[model samples]
Target: MIKIYHNPRCSKSRQGLSILEASGKEFEIIKYLEKELTSKELLSIISKLGIKPMDLIRKNEAIWKSEYKGKTLSDQEIIEAMLKHPKLIERPIVINEDKATIGRPPENILNII
Candidate 1:
């Protein structure tokens, strides 16, 4: 099944949802802000995305700039930061099977799904 870590308040996330709806494939929506991911879950997602922890961060978010920017953090530290400030996570992460993509362009989801 396809699963999307979504933030409805985000326009990009809404666009990603529109793309998923157009695809006609069933998907699960996780309101990540309301239901934050655990460190283990975030680590698994990073692994599936084939990227480092920083790659999944929404660096422009104030939470990051104010609290985490220019900090030398371990992988675990980054994951913990995201859990504490879920908005620091990049929006619209879609996962299908073992593959995952951060839906920045929204179209990125098409490649995985």
Candidate 2:
């Protein structure tokens, strides 16, 4: 089954969900905002993404700017920030089995799915 970490308010996230819907594949939606992810869950996602913690952050979000900008943070610290602020996470992360993708252009999902 496919799983998407989705933020419903984000247009890109919505687009990514649409792609999954169109594919007709079985999938689960993790509304990270409402449900909130655990430290372990976030870490697992970062691992599956094959990206540095910073790479998974939504740097442009206001919360990140006001709270975390211009300060050096370790990977663990960054992960902590994201867990404390789910809006700081990059959206529409799609996982299919062991492989995962960040749906930026939203089309990136096609490669893995």
Candidate 3:
């Protein structure tokens, strides 16, 4: 099964969802905002994405700029921040088995699913 950490308000996330719908494959949508992920859960996602914690962060988000920018945070700290502020997480993260991708272009999700 495929799981999409989706934010409906985000256009990119919506596009990714549209793509998944068009694909006709069953998938799960995790509206991460309403149901925030725990640190361990996020860590698992980051691992599956094959990226550093910061790579999954939306550095431009207000939460990041006001509180986390210019701070030399450890990987754990960044992941924790995202867990605390799901909006600080990038949009449309798709996971399939052990593989995952941050679907920036939305099309990137195709690679895994």
Per-model CA lDDT versus the true structure: 0.91, 0.95, 0.91
Candidate No. with top TM-score:
2
The list of candidate 2 runs beyond 4 A from truth reads: none
Instruction: For candidate 1, write residues 1-113 as lDDT tens digits.
Output: 99999999999999999999999999999998888788788888889999988888989988899999999999889888888998988989999999999899999989987
Per-prediction count of colliding residue pairs?
0, 0, 0
Per-residue lDDT of candidate 2, residues 1-113 (tens digit): 89999999999999999999999999999999999899999988999999999999999999999999999999999999999999999999999999999999999999998
By TM-score: ranked, best first: 2, 3, 1
In terms of lDDT, which candidate is stronger, 1 or 2? 2
Ten residues in a row with the worst lDDT in model 3? Answer: 76-85
Task: Give the distance in Å from residue 15's predicted Cα in candidate 2 to where it truly belongs.
Answer: 0.4
Model 2, residue pairs in steric clash: none
How do the predictions measure up, each by TM-score?
A: 0.96, 0.98, 0.97
Task: Tell me the tens digit of each residue's lDDT in model 3 across 1-113.
Answer: 99999999999999999999999999999999999798778889989988999888888898899999999999988878888889999989999999999899999999988
| Model 2 residue 8 distance off true place after TM-score fit, in angstroms | 0.9
